[model samples]
Target chain A: MLDFTGIEKERLRARWVSSAEAPEFVEEVNAFIDTLKELGPSPLKAAVEAKKEEQKEAPA
Target chain B: MIETIKQHVAGLLTEKKIAGFLGLIEKNGHVAPHLFKDGESLAGFTLGDRKTAGDARYPLNKTLVTLSRAYPEETFGVLVRGCDERGLYGLFRLNQLTEDRVIPVGFSCPAELSEACECRKPYPDSLVAGEKTESSQLKKVAEMDGKDLARRFDFWTAQFVKCVKCYGCRDVCPMCFCKECSLECEDLVAKGDLPVEVPVFHLTRAMHMADRCVDCGLCDEACPSDIPLRLLYKKTAQIMDTDYGFTSGLNKNERSPLSQMGPAK
Candidate 1:
């Protein structure tokens, strides 16, 4: 729903299912996991991890 | 022009039409906001020559709000350019001050001054000094509008990374009178994070400014990082105008659709 681009757009998904539609919810979750696998790790998370590593190596 | 303004203010003070006049004064080789009371002190009032415009532009409306809140019963006159007058109108809509309690002495800006600000309206409706000139749109916003979504996103993300989270923009904004700002909220924006969260901090501010921003460009001037904040807020104003048919600070009686509770008419 946000103005994200390329793989960033694939990183998020939303679906509405009734309480009785357990099969549909499961299918949606699986589809989201497959999409996540295809897209690999999130760029924002990678950037944060890299910053944390840099701080760890920095001299006091 | 300065003499004319001085005389006008002196007349107001002598006639007791206002308890004080809020305007600029030259002191210690600098110009700053001062409250002029007695007619005799009108000689000290100044418009601050063209050269001082860059450094001398103060949030006179914000000062007026503070003074009025303190006094409550007193009336005051203020020297206003186009931007300040727009701010007053916005404040009046927000119920910060009533129209009857404050009088505005308006003036126009020169072409060079207007060009520097990328101002769309450099003269107030009640102009008493200087001739009204054509307003200019910001060239940067126009250029950015033609770029692809990805390219525009990249440009904004790069600019947002430069932010030091100073909050100078909010402090200098005349319309930002909210006692509790979302920017300070720990949920929306985390505390003690360098560079702040990308796009969230700014986007939140942009959303808040959409209905209220008068396009004064003060936030742009106050930004230490030169982040082109005015351009972003100007785009928000454009969006509001296109989607909701609302223009801030234009009509005192008309309320922005976003501020109204019911469905838009």
Candidate 2:
């Protein structure tokens, strides 16, 4: 669904980690953080920024 | 075509198979849903044809759900198009209505109606009325799917921005039977706030109905903003079908793969 809306599928992640497996949870979170860094800021925020600039540039 | 349905329902009612048959009636040229009980006149029966093929259609299944709950002991027959049949089957699986208590009397969509809906299967497995018409060849979902990611983002953003937050999509949806909706939550969607491209309302709805959408297209029709809601939900349904091999419709026995018990045969 994220992919369908133009968001990278990698921006979302879901994994079941038992509470006993603290290391696994941390690893998953770190991996997602790395992925997010690579993807840059959210495209939704970019759309907001663009819309603001768009108003100043030319009216639709 | 409607004559066949009337005869079938009349026969069923005569045989005491159903307490009543719910269908549309044209009273004074206005189409509305009506329940035909035993010994009632069938003169006003209509298939929601007004100015166009199936232009005045209603979600009879929603009413059927309410009726079944109120009169659980009585079995009822319902007029179902391709989409209504799908909604009935979906409701059956959802446990909102039982299969044995409700009998489906189905009709196929005309070419123009089917094309307008862009339906995959515009007819039920068995028909009481109209003949099976070939599904519309339009591939809006596929066309949308083929676009580059950035283009999709912009396309969807523009569409979502136009939302007046009416929630007409959810209101008109036949497959939506949730007692409590996540969309109304204050944290999830800021109530009475400006419609944002964050698209929490639409996105949540899309994800919620991902496995359950019967492809009825009511959401698309109900949207005042004219958002391609069915197109969006169809994408989610497609992904579910691709990943889990689960598609909701006439096949009542098929279970959602997302469920903890796994797919039921």
Candidate 3:
């Protein structure tokens, strides 16, 4: 997770919560969802989709 | 200088110190890496002219690795420039070859060649020939540093788009010794893609190179598209130095910080 943190910082987040801390885990998940919504779709995903469409539209 | 190197190599061969001496040989006006088994064959040996750096350059360390693996008990000697010595240190750290098994005959690069390579250390650890000169700085990275994030991203993407996915960079690297490379992993990098996923391909390599890259500049030399790979890996080396005062090929006993499992001390 620390390695991935360097590449997609905004998209990926790591939180420390033990199995006993259900409430804390839920809170962290909710916060991450909000962050993702604010950040919108990843540019890499968008690029891949756009490339797929371009390939589909190209001549056979 | 060439005569001195030839004499030293002949001495090593005659003394039975090394089974074979891996050095450049000029035959039919073409210079290539060859293994001289005896002093008789040493007559064909030539220290490639310093005028053409590219012609003189070959992955001698890589050949040493291959030969050493085949003949584990047999010792070998090789001619090494500054970059080659650094690469040898990296290989030693990786446990690819023992220091005792490979004898390095060191030489320094000329000032012009050093400037052209943007080399930091123009001579090896123990210089047998040539004089040590100051290391040169890479101007391309400095130029890129002035650009904004978006501009830099665009610049890199445009440069990466020219890639034909030849993997010449990997093939030519002396320190790349992985049996199964992450670059070839289909899950990470798709197959048969002409340009490959630009970020996934390049960034993945850059991350892997952070601790391993010795600033040899071989990747940049091998790239047919003229992609500034040395600059990218140099940035990784800088990051490693800043975050954890570690640089590749500095000392054989010191392992790369990234290679450790726990947090940096």
Ranking by DockQ: 2, 1, 3
lDDT of 3 by residue, B1-265 (tens): 7788888888888999998889988888778899988746576676666457544578888889999999999999999888888889999989999989998998888888889877778888867888887888767656766666556655565566567789899889898889999999888788988667766687788888777888888788899988888888877776687789987886657788777898876
Clashing pairs in 3: none
The global C-alpha lDDT for each of the candidates, from Candidate 1 onward, is 0.80, 0.84, 0.78
DockQ of 3: 0.15
Worst 10 residues of 2 chain B by lDDT: B256-265
User: Deviation in angstroms for B235 in model 3?
Assistant: 0.7
Query: How high a TM-score does candidate 1 get?
Result: 0.83
User: What's model 3's TM-score?
Assistant: 0.85
- Native-to-model Cα distance after best TM-score fit, residue B117 in candidate 3, in Å: 2.6
Candidate 2 has what TM-score?
Answer: 0.90
Ranking by TM-score: 2, 3, 1
Between candidates 2 and 3, name the one with more favorable TM-score: 2
Residues A1-60, candidate 3: write the lDDT tens digits. Answer: 112212346566877899999999999999999989997765554544554555457622
User: Candidate 1, which segments miss by more than 4 Å at Cα?
Assistant: A1-60, B50-55, B262-265
lDDT tens digits, residue span B184-237, model 2: 777878878765436566888888898789888888878887889989988887
Model 2's CAPRI class? Answer: medium
